[model samples]
Target: MIFQLGCSHGLPGIFACLEGAAAIHFQDFNAEVLQCLTIPNVNSNVPSFQRPALQVTKCDAGMEIHFFAGDWREIHKLLPYAQNIDVSTGKGLDAQYDIILMAETVYSISAVAHLYELIKMCITPSHGVVYMAAKKHYFGVSGGTRRFLSIVEKDGVLASSMVAEVGDGSSNVREDQTLSLFFLFLFFNLLPCGCGHQFGHLPLIWRIKYCNRN
Candidate 1:
């Protein structure tokens, strides 16, 4: 199972569908975004013979696709695989996602806490992983990967590793230098003239996993 939070066009969820994920759930803030954009994008990309105008429970490849729209704090109630707690047993439903993917989600400091809370509720216990791509710092805004990781550290339930860091010659390189040589080679090859500075923020990808927290 996979869940994509704040899924605008649901590109990641659609890709998961193509990759034969058992289930993919997409959530966004607006119902209209899901109705108009996300569902259509899935139909187009997920290889259905006839594109249904309405959302269906299963696709041709037997992949289950679901969509939810609401605030992060409340969206878990609507997700099918959410980690709902059993009142009598004090145990989770164990229907959480195996993988979670989001890009540029932590752009607002105000929403960071809520987003993190939702992630905790939806990711599978002890083994689920999350892949997030975001800037190290947002210029006018306050939230970033660093800020999000700080919250994760304080919570002490999850451990994070930097998968890749994208620099544009504007930021200082640290001694640890998590950026790989292959990535650097590809970066320079794509730009050719070392013109990565044209883009603004210093993007970084992160891998997060459960740290024995239930």
Candidate 2:
């Protein structure tokens, strides 16, 4: 299970699907981008794309690949597994994502909080992790990995470790970072809150729940 936020070309998310993530959801601000670049690229790579409907062939336990377009602050409603979480406790009702991937998402300082909030809302409770790639900082925009980490540090909710750093003469993190888990599983109980914060819930524990039969 994985999510690609602010997916531009969606290579990382597509790769995750190839890497065996059963479900991969791609989100972008502009619907056109998803329709144009992202969807085409995905079709070229995976052969087909799927919505929430489950479809798997007998010979293959297929993957659920979904694409969404909208502002980060509001797209949760359209996402599955999102309406099944208890935001107060940080656990999910259905299943949260095992991993969340993002690149160049943190370039906007203003959207960082909403982005983190969305992550907390959708990610698995215990073992789920996030991998983000962005320049150390965006030149015009003051948003960067360092700036986003400050929010994580201040919250004191999730522990973080730098996975890699790219020193291309740019004072930015070239690699990615993973956010530590701090909660437990909560997929048994679900309270559907429509039009509310609907970040998908999956306490992956790194659990790989696919859409097809094994």
Candidate 1 lDDT tens digits, 167-211 = 666673211112344323322233211112222333576777777
Candidate 2's residue-wise lDDT over 1-214, tens digit each?
7788887666666566555667778888988777766666665565445332222211144776777788877877777877666767443555477777776677789999888777777777666777665556777888877787777777756556654454545244343563222111111112222222222322112111111212
TM-score, candidate 1, is 0.77
Write down the TM-score of every candidate: 0.77, 0.73
Q: Determine the backbone clash count of candidate 1.
A: 0
Model 2 Cα shift for residue 69 (angstroms): 0.9
Candidate 1: C-alpha RMSD after superposition: 6.4
How big is the positional error of residue 196 in model 2, measured in Å on the Cα after superposition? 39
**lDDT of candidates 1 onward, in order:** 0.67, 0.60
- In model 1, state the lDDT of residue 35: 76
